[model samples]
Target: MGAAVAAQAKQGGAEVLWCPEGRSTETRKRAIAAGFSEVSDIAEMARRCDVIMAICPPANAESVAGLVSAEGFRGIYVDANAVSPATMASIKAFAFRDADLLVDGSVVGSPPSTSKTTRLYLSGSGEAVAVVAGLFSGTAVDARILNGGIGKASALKLSYSSYQKASRVLAAVAHGLARDWGVQDELIDIAGGRSTSYLAEPTYIPKVAARAWRWAPEMREAAAAVGELGFPDELAEATAAVMERWAEAKDQSLGISEALELLRTDGPQTAPGPSAE
Candidate 1:
């Protein structure tokens, strides 16, 4: 997603810079293909760019911000990770430590591309949010500046992802259960009769399986937020546990039934293919 954002910026005629230090060779190749000017390190990027965005896993949000802060990257810092509002507040504390403006941002939908674009929800200093929004103007990234302060964007991201992802998992489990009773087709037909139903899209189960590793952590983050708000977190926690059953499916392709089998048994039935994540 970080690469997708940079590629979208470059497409929008913005001069984008990326630091390949500590990143994978595949990451470097993707950045190179996006036409991002490479710098030696984060310090170099901090010295050169007006804005720095971190679009990583939810677990790494704060550590990544600490790295940027240590380098004194006082430019507009956009933390676009999927974290809870409280986690975002902790990040805000350190991010503001260096007197740097922190813009809470979140990415919803898939990675932006010509075929499909994604939404970037932004919050924090109104001016800073506008500046970050302008970075992706007219690009594949739909930068939407919200009328809120730091953490609202992340809150919205978590709320949406929690339900959307859990529903996909629920669909897989429901279908698998129905199949055991010789009623899988009836289940699909029931869902297909609805205007919008995830159960009608069993083909997406394999894709969900491929992304479960990243998603399980996200659900836990959502559970944290729910617990913080004094609500029952069993739904999120249960979804995460189910996703963990398919943790070995990270970036691995498998058939719909095979993906569901992973949810039922500890050992997954593999259909060898290339990684997707």
Candidate 2:
């Protein structure tokens, strides 16, 4: 995702710089392929860039912001991670105290490889948000400013992903239960004859497992967001557990049937939930 964003920004006539201090070899390769110049240090990159966009895992959003803040960065800070509104507020309050402007940003849809497919939502001071949106102008990314203060875009992202990911979990649970009851075929037939085509097969299981490690934190964030809105967050919290179990199968190259078998036999063990603070 960072590579895609850098590629678009570079194509749109921006000099993209990245700090690949402890990133993997694959990340370095992708960053280079995206035409991003590697700065030796984060502080140097922070000093050179007009806008510092942190596109990372939800768990590291606050730390990334803190790193830039420690560098005494005063440019526009764009937090483009999947985090809850409360986390965003905390980041704004502490990690971005020195930032000239804080742009609460959230990315919805896949990475922007083609035009008009992915949307980058921004909410904050209107002028700062507009400036951040302008960086993606004439590029493949579709950037838009949401109406509200900081955390609005993050709230939207958490709410949307809560339903999107939890529904996938529900599908997996239903399929697993049907298979356990020795009525898998009947369940599939019923689902296939209905309006939902994707649920007919357990294909989404492996697909979700392939990225479950990443989705685990996202589900936890969604749980916190739902709890903040005065709703029971157990569904999302349970989904996070499901995702953690699947994380072990990420590299197993399991097919739909195999994934279902794994889920049924090796379900998630009791584990502590991710920290939203």
Q: Cα lDDT for residue 231, model 1?
A: 58
Error of 2 at 269 (Å): 37
Q: Which candidate is the best by TM-score?
A: 1
Superposed Cα deviation of residue 205, candidate 1 (Å): 26
- Candidate 1, residues 25-132, lDDT tens digits: the string is 999899888788999998998999888898998888889988888898779898899998788778877566432378889999989998998999988887788888
Candidate 2: C-alpha RMSD to true structure equals 14.5
Q: Please provide, for model 2 over 1-277, each residue's C-alpha lDDT reduced to its tens digit, 9 standing for 90 to 100.
A: 8788868888888889988888999999898888788899998988898898999999999889999989998889999999987898899789775323898899898888864467899988777888889989988888988886777889889878887887776666556555656888998898777675444556777887778889899989867765665556787788788778776776567776656655654453443322221
The worst-scoring run of ten residues by lDDT in candidate 1 lies at 268-277
Where is model 1 more than 4 Å wrong at Cα? 98-100, 197-277
**What lDDT would each prediction earn against the true structure?**
0.82, 0.80
